[model samples]
Target: MFILDIFSLQQNIDFSLRSLTISLLLGTLLSLALKIHYQRFGMSLSNRVAFSKVFVFITLTTTLIISIVKSSIALSLGLVGALSIVRFRTPIKEPEELAYLFMCIAVGLGLGANQWLATIVATTIILIVTIRWKRSEDQSLFLSLDWEKSHNIDLDQLQNCLLKFICDCDLRRFDSRDEREEVIYYINIANSDNLLSLIQKLKTDFPQIGISFLDKTTIPGV
Candidate 1:
């Protein structure tokens, strides 16, 4: 009889078991969608795999927490106190990443509070806008070059070459190690049409130097 009582208590539902299950499942699936969206459209320099993986966990955890505490003020306070002991040690390197993180958290909170309609509608709008903006716009890019200082590069000639191809070509990073020099510059190249020509010119003048664009990735279909 005692064993039966314990089993029955274990099976008891708090604030509708069906609702809890549905919210968690929906939140998890939404998080997965957002992860795919970010993976395809994110322009951050930091690799996104680590941060993207956390969305599902965060959403599910938040849903479960809210499910447990939604009915009582004391439980809510206890939840807060419990959460206060936790620490977020992972460093977010980009403001964009932070923005995305907050959005994911908001989704979890909304779903946890059982505001499914609001969460779904808002997430859909924001997701579509973000993807479209990233895909249709000219994203930011920088240029970097590395070569041996012994190569005797002419700064004036290089500046003239860059000026013909790009706007606001300003040197922002300069480094030297032993015999090699590394230089980074901010450049505005609105389109890829002139990129090959610029590369050809650079190669003609400095055949042995390494030249490449920074914060650039080969995102498929972007």
Candidate 2:
């Protein structure tokens, strides 16, 4: 009877290679779509192009691992143990990036469980909603300025310059030192053309000024 029980357990643990292969392929394609979506619509100020490169790999690997572990309770437990030892040090700077990663994992889990149709439909719907939400939200930008103290530029002069193209400008921070000065502002402009014009005007008037625009959702940085 023990021998027969062991044979049944072994048979239960055996999974179809064709199903695993199909799941992996689907995962790869979905991950690619996610990568493209993030690169285009994502609001993260980090190096998004470099960060998004991991989507495909993360999805495919998750699919493969889930497919293997789903066949047996012992394997699933072992997987949990193995994953607990792994450490990821790279920081995720924004909540948006973390949300995308969760989406990738969810896609892999659904496909790995052989719920392909449901996964595809749900992902499509979510991506569409994300696009609409982003479009409707107010987009504010953070502007950073740095220049040498030798330029003799003052805060009032900078505000005067900003008022020409920007209808609204709020000073966020100001730092001054022996030789260098830094200023941060929260500003709203209509379009890319306005941004370019502002940058050009700043450069023309104060050649030594350094300008950087950062996404308002993130910490203001160069």
Candidate 3:
């Protein structure tokens, strides 16, 4: 009697040149489109060019992960465990940024699964809706920050924080003495809730500092 094994352990990994190439190409193009859409229509207080990389990186990594895991159930489980252990401590200041990141991940998931057509179509629809929505609601808001500096003050960090929560922040004034300095910033933002929230968050983060926003139009001195 000849004994034959019907179920064998196959460890070999195979890549289809055509499918891999098409998926990656689609992912790259879709990510680029998302980056552009975000830069042009993003309503966040900070729209730094450096942030665009988040979309590109997330999309490509997702694509790679999905592609690699598709061939092995073992690898897919490993990915889940690895991701579960990782935690991000940094706060996401803008909801829109988080939404975009999620969209990028979705694109990556589709492409990695070799669903190129659906990824492309979905991306297009999302971009159109986001742009039009932003256009429909157009208003300008601004914030002003003034503080008498202390020895513990971090000038660069303060500026960066302002940029992160406001559309544009300019250093209108700065006066320094032996042990202290006075600083002023004029910020452009569009949401009253966000403005109040930012002020409260800043107060909580830096209790020693003075932070407030005033009505620019009512202020007499320019």
lDDT of 1 at 176: 87
Clashing pairs for model 3 are 45-166, 141-189
Assess the local accuracy of residue 212 in candidate 2 as a C-alpha lDDT between 0 and 100. 92
The C-alpha lDDT values of all candidates are 0.79, 0.85, 0.74
Candidates 2 and 3 compared: the better one by lDDT is: 2
Ranking by TM-score: 2, 1, 3
Task: Report lDDT (Cα) of residue 185, candidate 3.
Answer: 71
Off by over 4 Å in 2: 1-9, 146-184, 189-207, 213-222
State every prediction's TM-score relative to the real structure.
0.65, 0.73, 0.60
Q: What is the alpha-carbon lDDT for the whole of candidate 2?
A: 0.85
Q: Candidates 1 and 3: which is better by TM-score?
A: 1
* Best lDDT among the predictions, by candidate number: 2
Model 3 lDDT per residue over 71-136, tens place:
877677889999999999977766777898899999999999998888889889989987888866
The clash count of every prediction, one per candidate, is 0, 0, 2
Can you write out model 1's per-residue Cα lDDT over 1-222, one digit (the tens) per residue? 999976665455357778889899989889998888777677653466777998888878888778777775667888889889989897877787888888888888888889999999999999999877876655446788889988978877888998887655878888989999888887766445455578889999889889978644443442
